[model samples]
Target: MRLGIIIGSVRDGRFGEGVAQWFIPLAQESAAAAGDEVSIEVIDLKDFDLPVLTSATVPGAANKQYVDERVQRWSAAIDACDGFVFITPEYNHGVPGGFKNAFDSLGSEWAEKPVAFVSYGAEKGIRSVEHWRAIVSNFHMVDVRTQLAFSVFEDVDEQGSVAPTDSHADRARALVGDLISITGRLVTTR
Candidate 1:
């Protein structure tokens, strides 16, 4: 299975990337050691300067298109994945706009893919997960039921790595397993 983790926020002080950096590699390593041959990638929205939608652009997902080179590159990278793990942060009770814009740039890229989330924030990032799951579903993707929800006020350290909590780490590992399983099943159908 080709699994991609989309780092959800591109804000100046965002902690999302650090979390993704730790988890993506661990997932790859665990899969490798287990001989499951899972392939993982991280998709960062900052690489694609997808602007807020303008009045000049087309309106619906079917007609929407990328107007920037970054968005095009973003699509190419996303096109390589069979599933996703969205590392998200909760902001003002919702998801950040950058990730949403990245998703909007290409309508067909997400269909039939499976997705999972590792969301964190002051409020544990659960709202962000719910929001992302709905959006993924709208795009005709299946979001695995299991997820890793970390509280910004709790689990993460200043360095971006999760603190040494066996239970939390176990949950993360379980979520990754679920992601791999769902992705494998979905990809075969595709």
Candidate 2:
């Protein structure tokens, strides 16, 4: 399965990149254990030049006309992926605006895909992810049960490196295993 690991934060000094770096190898190992072919791609929201919803076309609209080439490329990337792992940071108890807009920019590309979360914040970013879960469910995305949440104060270092507790490895393994299992099942059905 083609898995897109989305970096959900785009601000200066964000810790998402380090988390994603830590996640890729675990995801790969989990897929290998299951005898599944997994290609992991890191999708950074900062790389996309997405404008806030100024286009007349909404994402789920029929015959959607994208505002520009960047949006098209973003949609294409999402369409190519079978599942996703979103690494997010809790900001003011919500997801970053850019991450939300990225989701709003495209529609059916996310439909029927399994989405998991690896979030960090003062207390594991659970509030932000709770909102995200509700939103993605509206898009018909399958929520992987094993979510990896880290407390920024505890899991990240001053150098902006991810230094998760030893127990987090087991949680990450569970998250990846669930992602592989759910995505594999969905792939067979598709």
Candidate 3:
């Protein structure tokens, strides 16, 4: 299973990246022990030039400012991956604008792909992910039920990494394993 861990926030000091850094390896290791090769890709929005989305410049527009060639590349990457792990932080009670733009630029590429969430915020980030789930559903992607939510004030250290805890680590690993199992069946059941 090829799982793309999409960093869903683009702020300079955003905590989502730190969470993904801690979350991905644990999941990949679990899949490896099951004798299934799972490929993990981290999709960071900062690396791309995706700007404010505009309809005149969104779908077929050649405008590289609001919409760029990189959007197309990002969409292609989604198509190549089998599933996703959206590492999102709650921003103003919803996902950040950049992440929404990144997701909005793509169509058809997200279809039939399984998705999961690892949300972090002051209140465990469920509010942000609730919006994300509905949005991914519009793209026809299957949103997995398991989640690993950490709080901004309590779940991390001064270095901005999740304070290594055994219980959360175990749950994180199991979440990935479950996603792999269910997604594997979903992809092949046809």
Candidate maximizing TM-score = 2
Instruction: Report the lDDT tens digits of candidate 3 across residue range 86-119.
Output: 8888889998788888887767677778898989
Candidate 1's residue-wise lDDT over 52-163, tens digit each? 7563554345343566666667777888899888888887888777778777667677888988888888888899889888888877898889888777667767765666
Segments of candidate 3 deviating more than 4 angstroms: 57-67
- Show model 1 residue runs off by greater than 4 Å: 34-36, 55-65, 157-161
Total clashes in model 2, counting residue pairs 3 or more apart in sequence or in different chains: 0
Candidate 1: Cα lDDT at 20: 75
Candidate 2 residue-wise lDDT, 1-190, digit = tens: 8989899888877778778788878877877787747777888888987778778767888344586888888888899999999998888899878899889888889999999999988888998898899989988999987889987778877775888887889998898888878998999987
lDDT over C-alpha atoms for residue 51 of model 3: 62
Q: Report the number of backbone clashes for model 1.
A: 1
What lDDT score belongs to each candidate, Candidate 1 first?
0.76, 0.85, 0.79
Each candidate: how many clashes?
1, 0, 0
Scored against the true structure, residue 139 in model 2 reaches a CA lDDT of 81
TM-score of each: 0.88, 0.93, 0.88
Candidate 2, residue 89: lDDT: 86
